[model samples]
Target: MSDLTRKTAAELSELMASKQASSVEVTQAHLDRIAAVDGSVKAFLHVDTEGALAQAAAVDAKRAAGEELGPLAGVPLALKDVLTQEGVPTTAGSKILEGWKPPYDSTVVKRLKAAGIVILGKTNMDEFAMGSSTENSAYGTTHNPWDLTRIPGGSGGGSSAAISAWEAPLAIGTDTGGSIRQPGAFTGTVGVKPTYGGTSRYGLIALASSLDTPGPCARTTLDAALLHEAIAGWDPMDSTSINQDVPPVVAAARNGDVSGLRIGVVKELGGDGYQPGVEARFHEAVELLTKLGAEVVEVSCPHFEYALPAYYLILPSEASSNLAKFDAMRYGLRVGDDGTNSAETVTGLSREAGFGDEVKRRIILGTHALSSGYYDAYYGQAQKVRTLIARDFIKAYEQVDVLVSPATPTTAFAIGDRINDPIAMYKNDLCTIPSNLAGNAAASFPCGLADEDGLPVGFHVMAPVMRDDLLYTVGAALESALAEKWGGVLMSKAPELVVNR
Candidate 1:
């Protein structure tokens, strides 16, 4: 790997601006990194070498012409496959949309291009972004870069894995529950789930319309903040898009000050069930914040206990409705249509053939939840609980600047450990579900490695809606404090991946 591959997005941007490194050089380095290690990491489903180089060349051309460019002009990024990119194959890690080339660019893609960021290619994800572990992905699972045997986290694992493996400095991810943040924790990277509607959802394939949020993933808080600003803002195309100005996340990340900041530790999110190492890192992170001039207090979000059940019900209900479009009538994989089968039979068979087991399970659960006779008992009650979760956040925010907890109950587990246990897989998102239910801005940053398993542990932060900057303020502060204590970033401790090539 070239030394260029180790540079953060910010450093790369500065190097390109100073005429020390051309965009093509930066882009090609990442492409080569992907080729060298993807067989083991399996982070990307596609690598657009030609397209990325062409984009990089264009940036170089503008620079040679003395034209002004965006702040992140020459940076290379891995895009999650769920977002549509014109003329690019977007499978969303499912057979249903296999080899499907979208006709239009998603809003996020448009913004990223406008910023002059090179799109290396799309990373793999869970089939329709359903499960908490990448094992559910139809294409294949993304292995954790730190340990090849452990999982990299699901739905957006490919995105985080790419960043962790140093194949790309920045990537995009969508968080329905804890997809982005949980994976970031597992991979020793940074992931942010902006407040619901904080980023446009127009181009993102819907898993749960109300809960799905597209956000940034990177190796550092400032890098994630930079991408957040570039891709976030009002989108007339998405009704749920927030019209307000993008939060000052970059500034907050750079500020790295938690002085006088009030931090609340969620009582329901810790103790019993949580692995000892995970709890240890979470408490240490809290103590570090206290020592850094922040006042820390234990805050109770009583309804948070119901977050998992409510999220399961609500997400599937919306997912069942959203995925109905893939009935093989329009575009994508169609099965059992030998010209003799009826349309209904084709739709049924196509879905049966296209969706993976986890996706099928969610669709069935969601359909049952939304059935006319059972809607009120299941989906409707889940909504009521969702409202209470939001209320808990409102009351907590009134007393504290932000909430904190461990991102996941345990560190990355062996790939096959939870593959057969649906209940065990679902529990991975226990600490992350409340943020999704409340529609708040939340993020996960590596706190330290677990003592028992020697895997990365994550310190999670939650902020009120639209107060996305607070996440960076706390994350950057802790990240800086911890880095100084260790004399380097936590990722320095990650076991090196042997790249064959």
Candidate 2:
């Protein structure tokens, strides 16, 4: 890999600012890295070589003209396929939308471009962001960079894997359940799920409208924070957009201190199902925080145990509604359009042919849940559980500045291990679903690798609504201390990918 490709987005930005390297050089280096290793990693669905270079060159020209620029200007990034990037093929990893180029950019893409960031292209994802593993992607699965045999967590695995594989310094991911943070834990990258509405969702292809949140993925905390700042803020176009000042995340990342802060260790998220190595690292991280002078205590949120069931219901119900737009008549794949066929038959043929197994599964479950007689029993109950989970977060936050847990129950599992067992796959998000259900800010930072598998384990942190800065404060502190003991970041320990010559 080129040294330029390995640098954090922050470092690359500095290099450009100092004129030591041009944005074109940095962008090309990443494109080259993608060409070398992406065959094995399978992290991206598309690679926009010409467009990325053009964007980088524009930034270089602006700098040459002495124009003011954003902190992340000239930095290259990978975008999740779920978000629209005008005229770019945006298949949310489903055949239904394959080859469909959006007419306009998503709010997230608009912000990234406004910051002068280079758009490398769309990364892979689970079909309709439904599955917990990228195996559900109609295109292909994104391999864990640490172990190509292992699955990167989904549905945003492509975004996390891109950064972990050093194909991109930064990436965008949407966390509906544990999509972003679970993958980050499995891949040893930083992934943040900003409070829902804190980041605009104007054009994100919705899986679960209420839960899908666009956030940043990077190799380091500060880099994630920089990307977070660039793409966050209110959007008049999105009714749910939070109309407040973006939390001071950049400042918190730089601060990295936990002294005197009250930290809560979630009582319900750990033990029995969690792997021993994961628990060991999580406890060590908590102990380390205590050593850093933070007051650590156990806090109970009993409702978290029911979060998984509630989320499965709520997500599919929302997904069933959001995915209704792709009914063959729209700008996606259309089938059975023979002159004799009725419109209904065409739509049915198109959906049956285009939707993947996982997408179909969710739609069926959701449709059943929302049926007139079952709606109150299933969907209504799930919403009530969601409310209770949110209340648990509210109650816990009252006793602590932030809450922490093991990002995943275990390290990266072998690809296909749980693909056939849907319930097993759903359990992967056990620790992360609550935050999404409650619409709070949360993140996963590399804590250490699991001793058994030698794959990375993530340290998860959750903060109150709009206190995204606290998530950074905790992540940065853990990253800084862990780096000292490990001699570098956790990704430094990942096995090198053999370049495809």
Candidate 3:
């Protein structure tokens, strides 16, 4: 493997700017890596080799002409299939939209292009971003780079897996109840869920409109921050987009000082359910923060206990409404349209054939929750719980600059471990749901490997709404401290994969 594939996005940018390496060389190296390992890792659903090389050539040409380029010019990225990229096939990991090439670019895609980032291709995801493990993907589950028998986190598992496998230095992922952060935890990479509206959601295939947040995924905190600034900011196209300046996240990640910072450990997020190795790593992270001069305190977010139940109800209700657009009328897969079938029957059959079991389950649950007679008892009450969860965050933020916890309750389990057990799969989002419910900024960075399984553990940090920079500030501090103690980045310890290069 070429060393270029191992460099951070920031490092790659520096080399490109200094003419030490051409954009085509960098892009080709990653494409080569994808060709070598992706068959085993199964990270990407599509690979845009031609488009990526063309973009790289354009950047090289512009550099030759002395035209100033964007800060991340010539960097390659792995885009989650949920985001629309003009003319690229976007399935969102479901057969429903299989081979469906989008006609236009999503706002996030446009931004990345304008910044001179070369998109390698679309990464895999859970069908419509629906499940805790990538097992729910209609295509197939993404296997962890650390252990091929285990799962990579879902629904954005493909994105995180790509980064961890070094097929792409940066990737895009959406967090709707832990999709981004959990996968990052399992893969020993960095994932951030910016404040819900901090990044535009116009082109993301909606799972739950209010909770879907597209953000950056990378191997290092600073790399994630660089990608975050590139893709974040107000967008008039998205009604929910925050109309304000993005926080100085890139600067904060570079600063990386946690002295005197007040950090709170959420009391409700961890306990008996958590794996012992995960808890051991979490406590070590807290102690490391304290040693770095952060004032670590245990803060109770009492209402957080209700986050899971509320998220399930609210997510399904919104998903029920959002997914209605895929009725086989306008575009995408259409089934049972023989001359004998009615339009309604075709629509029903198309959905039945296209959607996987988990998607069907959520739609049914959502439909019932939003039904006329049961709406008040289920969905309405869930909304009330959502408000309480937000209030819990608001109160906790008042006392501490940021809150910390284990990103997931446990390390990556076997691929088939919880597929048949929906409740067990749902539990994966327990720690990450509160942040999404509150629409605040949150991130997961590698802490250390669990002693029992030697799987990577993630330390999660969350900040107040629009104060996303705080996530990087704390994450960078902890990441640097942890790396020093471990003798290198946590990813250095990932077990090697045997692939024919």
Model 1 residue 238 CA deviation (Å) reads 0.4
lDDT of 1 at 317: 92
**Model 2 poorest ten-residue lDDT run:** 1-10
Q: Among all windows of ten consecutive residues in candidate 1, which has the lowest summed lDDT?
A: 1-10
For model 1, residues 47-95, the per-residue Cα lDDT tens digits are: 9999999999999999999999998998999999999999999999999
Superposed Cα deviation of residue 62, candidate 3 (Å)? 0.7
Q: Which stretches of candidate 2 lie over 4 Å from their true place?
A: none
Q: With candidate 2 superimposed using the best TM-score fit, by how many Å does residue 346's alpha carbon deviate from the native?
A: 0.5
TM-score of each: 0.99, 0.99, 0.99
lDDT of 1 at 381: 98
- Clashing residue pairs, backbone N/CA/C < 3 A, model 3: none
lDDT of 3 by residue, 333-429 (tens): 9999889999999999999999999999999999999999999999999999999989988898889999999999999999999999999999999
